[model samples]
Target: MNDKFELPPRRRLPDEIRQRMRTRVWEGLGEPDQRPRWTVTVRGRAPIAVAAAVVVLVAGGVTLLQSVQGGGGQPTAGGQATTTRPSQQLGPLLVPGVAQSAVDKCQAVAFAQTTPGDYAEPDRWRPRFSVSLPGREVAVFDAAGPVFCELTRTTVTVSPAVAAPQVLDVSAPASAARVTSLFQTANHTLAGTVDSQVTGLELGLANADGSNGVLGRAALMDGVFVANLPLSERGAAQGGRLLLSATTPTGTLTGSGPVPDGRVWQGTTVDVWPSGDSDPTSRRNQLDRCLDRALVNGLPGTDAEGWQPGARVGSAADQEGVLVAHRDDGQLVACALADQHGAELQLATRIFAPDRTANPDVPVTAVDLSWRFLTVWGAVGPRVARVELVGENTTATGEVVDGTFAVQLAGVTDAAGWETRNVLRAFDAAGNLLYEGTPVIRR
Candidate 1:
């Protein structure tokens, strides 16, 4: 009876079919009791239950296969297929806190790339980070342009990108008009107020043909800047313009203009000496004695008493003598004696007041002296043509050159421990006294 009730034929399932069945079972669709059942009749065998069972198993396998293949797992919030990849694999999403972390990372990277000695400070730079919505790809970028670092869920890239520094404004020497003493060589002091943002300032003097020559640097103090740029003799002879440049982290700003021949004296005269109660004649006599002593000790033709009247001196028409001295208003007055052939003896004496109160119009600005030379700078009247330095032992004279008087002391010596007093005098073309002052010298 079992042989008579046997199935017509039995065939083994293919490997692909078996795998599909296993996949469906794993997907929770092919449960034993939930599978469908069917009835099948074979042609030669009695009403066979085996055929019906095989048909039922095949129908259940087909339904389970469709469920596994057609309906796959949904994606995760990070845009990654949950079925294929775990949620943790998709890197952390960019939250506000994460953005800050990215900024810190970028800053570290930037510091590593920069030289240690660079003046730029890392804290001064402001940083910004990119953001992304949930369930989307999250990426990390550098704080600034030329992105150096990029971080993703599964990859990281490093590339150099440099951003320009922040620019700052320069407010000093607002215009070419603020430059002072642009052309005057004697008092070459350039001063102006600069913007607080400026870090460096420089003054350049170039020829009109755009050739570079002299450069002066300025220092900023309490928002004020001052530069003393004394041009060389060659530089002054060549006409040029003044350029004022300011530098910041961002860029450089320049202000330029034609050099002007500024006035010798621009402001009111300052009195450098105070009034005193000394008599003029007494002071002059003392100075005369000092000169007589120097002449007797240093000169060859003079005796202890110095040149005197009726003495067998040189045959020149002008018999020189050290005359009596006096003092007027704390100033020293000494005479240079000149006995002409026919005219009476003339004493060419000049009064020297240390203070500028002697003549406000002609103010001494600078006085430079060495062992055997003297240079005087002043705003003497325009009519003055010669400047002289009268000392105890010798007289040094100089002509106006570029608004200054430089002279070499012919008879002076650099004897150590020997202190001497000298006076500066100015004269016009007619030998008329214009200005005189006692020059302060450091032995």
Candidate 2:
């Protein structure tokens, strides 16, 4: 016998609807193999309990399935069900200059911890950029349209390199600077200011033709700099300009301008006396005689016998004044206060033997050694004040008098094994090492 239960007036559902209902039933049962067989019943044809149970199962299954699938099986008012692409974590985006391995590692870590909704548009997500900082730290950024995420790690840091700044500022002098205009003088002083950042300043004297002479350099102190320059007399005669340049960590600045016309000193003579002295007139007369002697002997045309009065005679209180005179040939005659009264007068001149001369003709020509006394005689220069005899183990000193120098040499005696090498040196009134003579052998 056929034991089947069916409701009267059975209606056939569409194939698509039947498939959807089957899918819902399987989904509700959780396991497709565990789904129970269902018997359909028409309205008002079967027992109330059976018909009610069928209605409840079919309604709940259809509602749940439609919600899960976003109403896929049925059409909305728009005529078709809307769908969207599944959200996904995209592959690593490469950044220029960054290593590929680094990008891969960063992407792997970000994707593992990220969810689909973590990004508004997961499909559009990409690596935006990265920065490396100190202490082995790296920052990685991922962006999707307007949304972005920043990931930091302590593995590596890729800091961008920057260049140092080169900035400099310089101000030119308001007027030209001038030194002595005498044909033989070349000493001059220049002063200016530079930017605080500048560390050094160089001044170059160039001829009219643009050829540069010796350059003078000076260090900046609190942004101010001063340089003592010596210009070539020939270059000055031909006309030249001064070039000032300053250096900073970032760059260099340069400026050029005309220098003042150096004019010859036209003064004749200078007189100086003690500032607070008991006898002012006598002191003045003494200084006058001393200066007159220097001009007569030092100058070429001046007659030593016939005393001629100087044109300019100015006195100073401290006896620390400079005596400058101009000759007919434009040569400078300058004398500085050497020793005050009771002391010999001194003058400033380039007449002293040049430095590093082998035979400095210091007047001590012969050394007369004796058991009673020792005498050294020669025409010592007026600038020579004292002479010293230095040996390997002994020393002797002498005083300058009447263009001659003498020393006693008391303890030193002439002996066979006592032979030693000796050197004679001369010093000016100002205690400057004026001359170093050739070696003298003493036995």
Candidate 3:
């Protein structure tokens, strides 16, 4: 963050809290992004959710209101630029910068013109940074941040972008995330930025058998990294999945997201293989779209507390998705569910939390939810080694990972008869019986 934008001593928030809020808002903007904006190596920050999103909307609203008033705005036909000088308004110029004539064209495009919606015309926009690449990237920014990205072949403009001083965060040292589509170039490629600590990078596609396939190392310069993608390697199925990774001293950080079409990122395709690798990372990675929704849409008060991604329990075309999310701390366990609407899994319904304890020797609480579907999922005791679903026409084992436990069930079973159709038996490592009971059928 630029320190020029920092609050005056009299108006400043606590340094720590203010930092967290800024991180959350910037990271939260990544609803469609596949990689995390911040790292979880230490796990101090919370994922941005509905609340942080509201902050962004509200900020935009403030800009709208200010713009409507006599506040500063871009130069209209006869209007003059704000008296605020240009140099104070931008970040550093990227190395191998574009020619001044192109920069002059960018300066002509008002900052307000670059962004969509009615925003107060910035005092002025200047070219904080300019990069000459196949993707002509220009940063038209005010101290607030990059106002908008001009990815076109020509342009130059600077705004009050880098006037602020920043407090360096030494604990985590670096943060990374996938760039949004607004700046995507025509060539099939993925783009991201990195700090000096990220010395090397590797990007690849998740394979059919849960192995990794190299897409080629990313090309980095001026804090930006762009990797050419093999278009043939990406498809609508299980094999061609591209994932994100950044290398640091501790270890390599990795992430997955929807496929990039050189235009827009595609939603992950999902499928289940109960008969396959017990559980494949590829299946879980694809189903992550469901888990990602938990960060943005999950509401504990509404019972949709699911977060971590897991293997898809059923077929992808059918559209239903299920994952058991165990909280980082071992106190509670819950299910995250998304239902089939058409060809894909829809935003998950709110009724997700089982809200039960999963301690040693505790009985696993099975709960049945969804009136339209017969879904049986619930808590798994920490010490319990296995949970088997017995009764019905056949016996099936729940996929238990860490403190989570979930199984796929056909909606063909009668909701009224689910309790009698299946019983859950949990056992410890010694195969000693922890407890057994029918599901707590939901309304």
lDDT of 3 by residue, 29-86 (tens): 4543332222111011122121111221222221111012121111234444222211
List ranges where model 2 is wrong by over 4 Å: 1-187, 231-236, 255-257, 262-401, 404-443
Where is model 2 poorest over a 10-residue stretch in terms of lDDT? Answer: 47-56
Best by lDDT: 3
Model 2 alpha-carbon miss at residue 435, Å? 25
Candidate 3: where is the Cα deviation over 4 Å?
1-291, 296-312, 315-319, 331-360, 364-373, 414-417, 429-432, 441-443
Per-residue lDDT of model 2, residues 213-295, tens digit only:
33556423445443443333323454655556656676666655554443332111112232333452343344344444333
Number of clashes in model 3?
Answer: 26
On a 0 to 100 scale, what is the lDDT of residue 170 in model 3? 16
Compute each candidate's TM-score over C-alphas: 0.23, 0.23, 0.33
- How would you encode candidate 1's per-residue C-alpha lDDT over 312-417 as one tens digit per residue? 1111333322222222111111222223211111111111113446564253333323343443333344566777778777776754532333333434444642
Candidate 1 or 3, higher TM-score? Answer: 3
Query: Candidate 3 lDDT (Cα, whole model)?
Result: 0.40
Task: Give the top-scoring candidate (TM-score).
Answer: 3
Q: Return the lDDT, model 3, position 10.
A: 46
Candidates' RMSD to native: 49.2, 50.7, 21.4
lDDT of 1: 0.36
